[model samples]
Target: MQSANLQKQKLELIEKIIHTDDQNTLDFLKSILNDETSDYELTDEQKQIVEEATAKYYSGEEPSFTWDEVKNNIRKRNFQD
Candidate 1:
């Protein structure tokens, strides 16, 4: 997209946000704007899992699933009704 179009879309979004009366919507926007990576802390076990996953990803030692495959797998596992 062009920069001009991006700026126009942003302005439209800002206008919509300004006119929105829902407190939940406003709070969501505020949280999104204020959110930072530093706000999240991972436990030691979670960190170890992430490091292992990262290594496997970089080394191509594990297979990957497409979005469709992942969703289908989840449905098969969890939505057996």
Candidate 2:
């Protein structure tokens, strides 16, 4: 309900932006759109770490925790120091 209204408002704002003749505003909007659509590139070391984690997960070498346990652990850590 609230989400639908927000979506409608976004569409209305976008329509207004589309009809604008301001070059600076249009260029700023284009840059923002490009940034949003761009893919995130990870460094080699970061990629290696992600690959290692993926391998561990697929090899059943990674420890898995339930959502409730994870939340409880987070709460404990947050409350403690």
Candidate 3:
């Protein structure tokens, strides 16, 4: 099932690449396939924070909210009449 989905995705990407004429976009996609080096890096402290947060979320120790819940809370706070 996953393989079928992946093949579909690959075909869609191939179609897009064939139809795309923008040199910059082609260059960016080429770099994605060719580049091995990643430029983004996090500091030790930042990495620790992220790891802790992920652990808490997975362990059900942290509260999580949906996008709608977040927007409603923001509106309640800002739009009181």
TM-score (all chains, Cα) for each model = 0.46, 0.46, 0.49
Model 1, 1-81: lDDT tens digits are 579989999999999998999998987788889882335689999999999999998899998889999999999989786
Across 2-78, the per-residue lDDT of candidate 3 in tens digits comes to 69889999999999999998998997888789974756699999999999999999999999999999999999989
| Candidate with more favorable, higher lDDT: 1 or 3 | 3
Q: CA shift at 25, candidate 1, in angstroms? A: 5.7
True-structure Cα RMSD, model 2: 7.7
Give me the runs in candidate 2 sitting further than 4 Å from their true place.
1-35
* lDDT for predicted candidate 1 compared with the true structure: 0.89
For model 3, the superposed segments whose C-alpha errors exceed 4 Å read 1-38
List all candidate RMSDs to the true structure: 5.3, 7.7, 6.5
Worst 10 residues of 1 by lDDT: 31-40
lDDT of each: 0.89, 0.89, 0.92
Clashes of each: 0, 0, 0
What lDDT tens digits, residue by residue, belong to model 2 across residues 1-81? 579889999999889998999998887788897876635699999999999999998899998789999999999999997
